[model samples]
Target: MKKYLFYVLSFFTLFVYAQDRQLSLAADVWPPFTDIDGEKSILSDLVQEALGRMKINSTIETMEFAKIFIEINSGRFDGSPALWISDEREKYYFFSKPYFYNQLILVGKKGSDVSAASFDELSGKKIGVINNYAYGDFDKNQEVEVVSDLSNQKNLENLLSDKIDYMLVDALLIQYMLTYQLNDVTEFLAIGKKPLLVKSSHLALGKHVQNAKIILEHFDEKIKEMIADESYNRILELNWIKADVDGDGKMELVLGGNKAGTSAPQNIYGLMHDNSYKEKNPPQRYYVDGKLYETWDNIPNNYKLDLVVDSTPSIEDTYIRLDFLD
Candidate 1:
């Protein structure tokens, strides 16, 4: 009886020690998704909570997107929340089951009539692309006008100004840009009926990390459980659902009123014209002193305004602040 008791105690002690092991995560500010605003990623939060329920602790470190990938490859971090599973990457990383899917799209100006029936048709056109981004087969042997900075607003500006014929960008990111930054001057038309590339994103474990394969297997099982129990869907709904900020059942905010200042008066007023609120809404809003502020700079850098609202508010306002990192 004493031997059995000792065995049970040893098992419990090992379990406790395992539970206390911290899982290090590397992430970047990929908006409406992963960001480093005090445990603010919806996917990250869900994963963290799930880990907690499984008796694992995790600490996320936010860094540049490029650096995050580099660190993960070099085993400086244990894993990253979302990364594409590619052949080149497979050599250095073990991937969990895909938790989300995304598409790479070709975005052109609204009125541009430059649709190509096939990939072969874009042979000579100056194609703007983020440096080192894998567009699957679409990127193979294609001549591209590479933009080293993928998230820079200037790349879109160049596309709008006709410096480049078309730019390859993430579909969701293009939608966000149209809703917020490039609404006035730029619009995106799909270059082809099919996506330029379709890819799945997974939690990637570094190759050099000890027991990486085993860790990835555990992560895979957890993800499967989350999906089977419908927890994954709940997380998606929490992050992706369009929110109506103006109480219109639509997601738009109309700002054209008497209070709009003269310098940028027409710009704000134009938002309300022709019932634009019926269309898509902004993913987030910036407000100060009960009045909605338009631009990022409008909010005093020091005061830290009243509210920074999201399409879906996951964490408390004090814990997270939203800004266009790109």
Candidate 2:
């Protein structure tokens, strides 16, 4: 009887250890977002912090971008910290709330004519862009000649070499590279004032992983908590200060830091900042009720009913339930 009890106890202990094994996350050498050798990046840090909050241990496996996708989809690694949602990807993975915004803009040589008021105007122009990247509506425009490259570095290099007229690149990526890696290259390029496209990035988990849904929920909850506690701001080194900047009594989110001299607060969130408000400043961040929105036009009709101030429905009505976080 004593021998049988010892065997049972040992088996249970081994089972628990196996079940609590650290999860593996696949990533690539995407700078600012991820750096394999350095084991640092905004997304990587955010993921680690969220997991740590949940007391979950994990390891990041650096691999090629293509292989990262393939392996994660096959359940070789648990999931990826950064991924855009698509019909194909949704089939094999569960996505969490957006952790980063991918705002894309155009870059060209100094003194070059990079003016293209619309996509149609870009016809017959050679525009360099990252391959397999979704540039929102720009992807549908077949008129412009898009030169695809493997990475942002390659696309930027092509731009500098005059291989392409203008390169469509992520704002954050260019900002990081210019600030850290390629400061000397700044004098050669001109960045567009207006953004060309914007997309939100999410944490993608393999559908086959055990308790994937629960894990996703917990991760998302931790992200919200991080944002509320201003821990997220510290990670990014940006002060997303929340206060009534417009003196409307309701709180507004302003993006700035104490290091830089403060500028006029931009009312980017809520319906008050919408086009219907008739204010000069346009909406920066869009959201409605309980759900955060990528664009004003994408907000649901049900929410629009209560948001219409003059009984006129406009696509620019933005109002996120700030109380929801409380």
Give me the candidate number with maximum lDDT. Answer: 2
Prediction 2 TM-score vs. true: 0.69
Model 2 scores a C-alpha lDDT of 0.61
Clashes of 2: 2
Model 1 is weakest, by summed lDDT over 10 consecutive residues, at: 264-273
- Among residues 3 or more apart in sequence or in different chains, the pairs in candidate 2 whose N, CA or C atoms overlap within 3 Å are 270-318, 271-318
Q: Which segments of model 1 are wrong by more than 4 Å?
A: 1-17, 38-43, 73-75, 114-118, 137-139, 174-193, 238-326
- Each model's lDDT comes to 0.53, 0.61
Error of 1 at 133 (Å): 3.3
Error of 2 at 203 (Å): 0.5
TM-score of 1: 0.59
Total clashing pairs in model 1: 2
Clashing pairs in 1: 251-281, 256-269
Candidate 1, residue 49: Cα displacement in angstroms equals: 4.3
Cα lDDT for residue 156, model 1? 67
